[model samples]
Target: RGLFPSFFREAQRREVLLEDLLYVSSAFERIAEATEEMLAEMEDSLRKPVDPEEFRHFWLALAEDLEREL
Candidate 1:
């Protein structure tokens, strides 16, 4: 299976250029929202401030998820 799933089939007609890009953009937004939620959960569990190293892991995961979703 493709890592980034196509949102539409080839048989479907495109009425306007860049219309499909909107769908992909929305999917990316969802991916970002999920990442933010996961990070928030981690933040909630921590008594001390989140360290730079820990934040880097969270950011890398977000980027990876966005790449896959896109």
Candidate 2:
């Protein structure tokens, strides 16, 4: 599924060009790539044992991040 088919549909109805959509989509593409890289790094770190306190801190920080907007 696409991220925002309805949004693109509306934009098209409003006469937005395909080039404009492609231009804006680059930002989403970059964000997705960066997120994948960060998650990969986190996964590599977690492959080994971690300190209990540090793990707790990481979870708390992630929760705080999720509580806010991107």
Candidate 3:
């Protein structure tokens, strides 16, 4: 990935171990899994929803994830 070189550079500077790098990779995988699940559950109907609570919960989860990214 475009970011891989930069990540490796920083990892080298920090002397991060191969084991720690594996853990970091796992973190990215978890994020991917969560994102896929959220989309599966909500994105197909992201435009709008009939139920008030479903609308609220979906937007809240999306907003939380956005904030976490920032």
Clashing pairs in model 3, backbone N/Cα/C closer than 3 A: none
- Candidate 1 per-residue lDDT, tens place, 1-70, comes to 5533443543244534467888889999999999999999888877577699979999999999999999
Rank order by TM-score, top first?
2, 1, 3
Q: Candidate 2 — which residues are off by over 4 angstroms?
A: 1-16, 51-70
Question: After superposing candidate 1, which stretches have Cα over 4 Å from the reference?
Answer: 1-17, 48-70
Residues 1-70 of candidate 2: C-alpha lDDT, one tens digit per residue: 5859988888877675666788789988999999999999999987978799998999999999998856
Instruction: Go through the candidates in order and give the clash count of each.
Output: 0, 0, 0
Point out where model 3 deviates above 4 Å: 1-16, 44-70
Worst 10 residues of 1 by lDDT: 3-12
State which candidate, 1 or 2, has the greater TM-score: 2
The alpha-carbon lDDT assigned to residue 26 of candidate 3 equals 100
